[model samples]
Target: MSKILIIEDEAAIRRVLVKILNEENGDYIVEEAEDGLSGIEKLKKDDYDLVLCDIKMPKMDGVEVLEAVKKIKPEIPFVMISGHGDLETAVNTMKMGAYDYISKPPDLNRLLNTVRNALDKKELVQENKRLKKKVSKHFEMIGESESINLVKEMIEKVATTDARVLITGPNGTGKELVAHWLHQKSDRSKKPMIEVNCAAIPSELIESELFGHVKGAFTSAVKDRAGKFEAANGGTIFLDEIGDMSLSAQAKVLRALQENKISRVGSDKDIKVDVRVIAATNKDLQKEIEKGKFREDLYHRLAVILIKVPALNDRREDIPLLIKHFAAKVASEQGTIEKEFTDNAIKLLQEYDWTGNIRELRNVVERLIILGNKEVSEADVKLFASK
Candidate 1:
């Protein structure tokens, strides 16, 4: 059921609104307030899906009520009620976050339609928030080691800004996790975060993949297509394995970083993009630059904030925590009872070398869970988790 509050100074108009709403939909629970002051007081006491406020009222006015409600419960949709002389004020109220407006002696169709739309928008906003929380949980960083803590601190300082970040680490050290955290905590989290694996794409097609292509630009280009840069406008684009990107593509990426623009393959027209870039690589880019495999200028442009993730071998103290986390995660995913690792089992695993880092450790934990007894033992690690 939808709860609505009608705030009108005139008793007759308030009654008509309540009656119209009640008649229009049985699910609508309409509440009334004779003045804006009373309406605000009621709002503070309980939650309402919608608010209809009169532009002119005694002791308080609709504009004041709208501003107050925005501060307290900005999610509640407000539909301003206006008289003949209040039309201009009604439009201005929209700039102040009002959902919509209805003139006095309201038109039935317009009022009902506006009310439904505002409610639908409120539902969408709520669903987006819920999904964001789920995504954050999935990408959670699970370690408290000093090295990991330093990376966390850097993220906290840099995530809110539009700065470019270069994440460097060996394969499977969770370079991608740092990128996801930066994008999720940024101002542009509401927008999409497009990920492009530079090494996965063929060197010949990398340019077209990142910059799009017009129809007939190439044999495969049958239709005009927008690329990662355009699709990531108003959000973030994460470039993984960036050191693998071709030098030709590197030049184009450098131009986009410098000018905030990109041109499609075989097209000279520049498309402006507002995207924050977060790039990661497992290779030493400085060596690549010296070897003429990477661009020095592009490296400088992307390294505004550098975060190097420590290898699992370097942070072996975090091994027990990671083993527990992965054991639980794997059990849940496979729909089996969660297993406990014996203290000897955990200690034995931690002493082993993690050449493949967290990725290798997780695979080992999953294997031990499947093959070991209810209580995983050090013997199980030797039998199932070789290397």
Candidate 2:
């Protein structure tokens, strides 16, 4: 239900306004105040969806009330009431943060309509805020494990500085999550964090994908295109699976890192770029470096700050906490009652070798949610989890 407050100094006008609103829309719960001071007092005491305040009242006026309300609870929509001679005051009140204003001897039609509009607008603003919060939760990192704590500490220390990071871990160990946190918690959080997976893109096209191309530069290139490095200007560019990148591409990447510039294919002009490099790989770079597949110079440049994400097997002590965290997260996403893991079920999970790490664990938890009856038991783990 929507709540509204009227702060007119005249008793007759306040009565007429309340009666019209109450009878006009029984769904609305309306309250009345004879002055701005009383209106502010009511606002502090109660939570109203919308406020209809009058200007030029005793003790305090609508403009003062509007400013105070903005400071305390800015979301509550306030509509001002003004006399014909106070039109300038009303317009000025809006500049001070009033949602809207109505002139004296209120038009019943206009007042009712404005109140409804204000309430609806407020509802939408509130709903958008709630949805954004929900989205932020879906990606929130939930853990205070020793390894997790160390990673957090490292992030706080390294994020504010402009240092190229090399994150190494097994697949699904959340190497990507760490990179994301580094970018988000960094001084460059406001800037975009562009990502390119070297393993996913074809070797022939990886150069073009990273350095862009001019129109007609290649048979498939129909128009001018900007590369990830260009797009990540004044931001961070994440190169995932950098170990899989070809030697030629790695050489070009090294040059870009050394010079802070990139030249597009079939273009002579060098494009200046300012980007923080954060690269990740599941493969052992040292092995790749030995095999002559990865460049040693590029390795040295990118490894200014090395962050190794511990695999799920290595962090078995955190299994129970991770399970509870993932379970609640899964339940919230699926809009279902959270499932509990029996003691035996948890023990069974702890014993299993999580080859795929946290990603595999999340999938396992989701499976239990869908197939397990009541509390997930030891039997469920052996049955559904593919790995």
Indicate which candidate wins on TM-score: 1
Model 1's alpha-carbon lDDT is 0.93
lDDT of 2 by residue, 27-136 (tens): 88888888888888999999999998888899898889999999999999989999988899999988888889998898989988898899889989887655432324
lDDT of each: 0.93, 0.89
lDDT digits (tens) for residues 1-387 of candidate 1: 999999999999988888888999999999999998999999999999999999999999999999999999999999999999999999999999999999988988998999999989988988876664343767879899999999999998898799999999999999999999888877789899999999999999999999999999999999999999999999999999999999999999999999999999989999999999999999999999999999999999999999999999899899989988998899999999999999999999889888899999999999889889999998898898876
In model 1, which residue pairs have backbone atoms overlapping below 3 Å? none
Evaluate model 2: give its TM-score.
Answer: 0.64
TM-score of each: 0.68, 0.64
- Candidate 2 weakest lDDT stretch, 10 residues: 129-138
Error of 1 at 183 (Å): 0.8
> How many clashes in each candidate?
0, 0
Q: What is the lDDT of candidate 2?
A: 0.89
